[model samples]
Target: MENGNGLKIMEKNGLSLNLKLQNGTKVDNGTHWCFRGNKELDTPPEITIRGVLGMLKDSLDPSDPRPTIPLGHGDPSYFPCFRTAEVAEKSIADALHSANFNCYAPTAGLPSARRAVAEHLSADLPYKLIADDVFITVGCTQAIEVALCALARPGANILLPRPGFPIYEARAVYSHLEIRFFDLLPEKGWDVDLNAIEALADENTVAMVIINPGNPCGNVFTYEHLEKVAETARKLGILVISDEVYDHITFGSKPFVPMGVFASIVPVLTLGSISKRWIVPGWRIGWLATNDPNGILKKTRVVDCIKGYLNISVDPTTFNQGALPHILEKTKEDFFQNIINTLEHTSEICYQKLKEIDCITCPHKAEGSMFVMVKLNLGLLEDIKDDMDFCFKLAKEESVIVLPGIVVGLKNWLRISFAIDPCSLEDALGRIKVFCQRHSKQK
Candidate 1:
């Protein structure tokens, strides 16, 4: 390396190592060895959604009359059928009237709100939980972030679902935690591949995240499957973080099973929100419920670790916290039933339509949640290259915006949200069919 004086700098005798500009100009080695920033940053994240939607933002014309059909986000509040219940709105308004909620809430959460979540969730568990076991978070997203941050340690690892939510991966990466992915076998209607999880875990693994009524795949776990998950986590000597954010939206053959039911055998951290069930995602109230009936989490001080972390975290708005019980109880039965019916009908339309698209295949009809994960057969499409390319082309050619499955760590597959209004869902599917047919290999 040459210094500014055009003197050749010796490797060993120089004050520091090779330090020079790209033009071989002299630079202080201090800039080169500036310590304490993440060095592993350039490494691609194990999963993310960035590249999936990159091209969509650039290609769309402002004057185009066709609206963007969003099947990428899970929220359906924009759809009439899935809007928040009127009673929920009134309860939140009522809570706002109380000056008592104006102060900063306790770090763990507001006491009354925690108690309400505990009582509501405990209705399904064999063992009851107290307010101390419930921690209010900004939303389920933060609940997962806190759990991952709390459990992360040097050389520590965590297991995640392959075709799962990417927020887990994002938080894990930010916390510098190593991640090992386990597959949910689509062949078996999206059951967890136990052997794969067993292969991934060792002493370093601190926890495994399981999504019930899964995110991208949308199939609910059976009690038997959840029992096996609990047993596996127990054997691996790690905790289970069950994300039940989509708890009761099932319309398939199997019902949604709460993993907390098996908490007696293994410590479980349950993450949930009022987002899906109550159709109030923007309200952003969620809870992190610790279910360790055997007290393993308490014994290990994991519970305390979570509390310490929460002390530095933000709580859900105090007003939203106060609205918990009312939202849980007062949301009418008819409102709940109508949302489920809308989801089911929309999912059926997607399923039937995708089957007819020559280039695409749905492995399983979505039974819960708002999305379905489908495999795109590249061999059947003429111009598209892969999932990302296919989605880019689909968005450009058809004005439809479905998520590329590669965002969820699965390639050549896509997760489509059918949670929009029925007519919009119909339009999106029609566009998808037209796009596929126009690009078909047969064409």
Candidate 2:
């Protein structure tokens, strides 16, 4: 039978009616479904690490007997040496068995979970944080999303670090926020270029993001440098979104300084998670804490906006949130020390091996995060064209995967992850050295 709007409607016995329309029929395409037709989202300019690495994985020879070595990204859970703490495992198991937290978690997270996160982070901060100041997220990625969404506005722009993590750039693009790049001087141990940041900011600049214990570069900022960053944000009258996902993972002379320490100097939003430190990225528990002691964020309605976003977005798993208190409080200090010790040893091995490779130059030793950003000497190689070409060739020849720097806003550089087992990391670096030697121009 024909309907008033649709050309035809057919009803089958005990089945739902099927509506079929003529080719030229005009139908209501609601705003909710309109985004599906947006071609811009189908092909974003930003390339994700996973997307690039997956492409390399596909190029590997199936007949090769050697196990594929992945030096591409920063997940170390597959290696035995990087096993998560037993206390963390027990905490989650206990939570699951308790039969107390099967329901959906509150949008801002369970009160107990929020309180635990606040207290855990406050231990390192100058001022204490209350549960209300902390909002649990699905993970640090969502925390970043919420922070960017809260700050995004028409005619507003945000400052980002070049040779930095691409997630910030991806989110900025998706949110339609204008992005301005500030340089991180690789020669100066990846420190932020304050002059460039100053030049990038205008009256419309709403926020700036800083990744301490830096991603890809693995350079931890000193206390003095952090203070300067806070001062700069204050001078610009802009908020600071500090990504501290790698907190306490430092294995260097300088201690990890939380930007929250200078929250009183400037309004700050600190995004963090137990993923890196606890070795539980799959657990997906993270938080965004408003670190303003003077209530600047609250007064500016930023906090309200964050809460509003959380209200509509999906919450973290309830049982996982239930496990947080025990995981944060009971995990022994020795466990953390062991992780730092292993990373320090592996980083040293990676640095020494890369130093031997004539086609690669690591500017600074990795001190905190799992990665080291090394400049690729393409001029020294006969065949390789750029970082992407080098990575593709490396993967095909040796079944070794690495992330090209172009994905992270830098071309002709490579990001190497050394968080795997020391033996595996050594073998992987050996394969890389062999591959580079085979393709050297002098060869």
Candidate 1 lDDT tens digits, 1-443: 66675545557764655554544444455444334435445545324565445456555555668988888778898877788888999889999997667878888888888998899898888889999999999889889988998898899999999899988987898788999999999999899999998999998999999998889898889888899999998898988999999988899988877889999888899999998888778788898999988888888888888998998887889888887778876777888888899999999999998888888888888989888999988998887888888887777777788888888989999999999998999899999999888888863
Q: Which candidate achieves the best lDDT against the true structure?
A: 2
- Candidate 2: give the clashing pairs: none
Runs off by more than 4 Å, candidate 1: 1-47, 50-55
Candidate 2, 376-412: lDDT as tens digits? 9888898888999999999999999999999988999
Model 2 lDDT at residue 106:
83
lDDT of each: 0.85, 0.91
Residue 290, model 2: Cα distance from true site in angstroms: 0.4
Point out where model 2 deviates above 4 Å: 1-36, 44-46
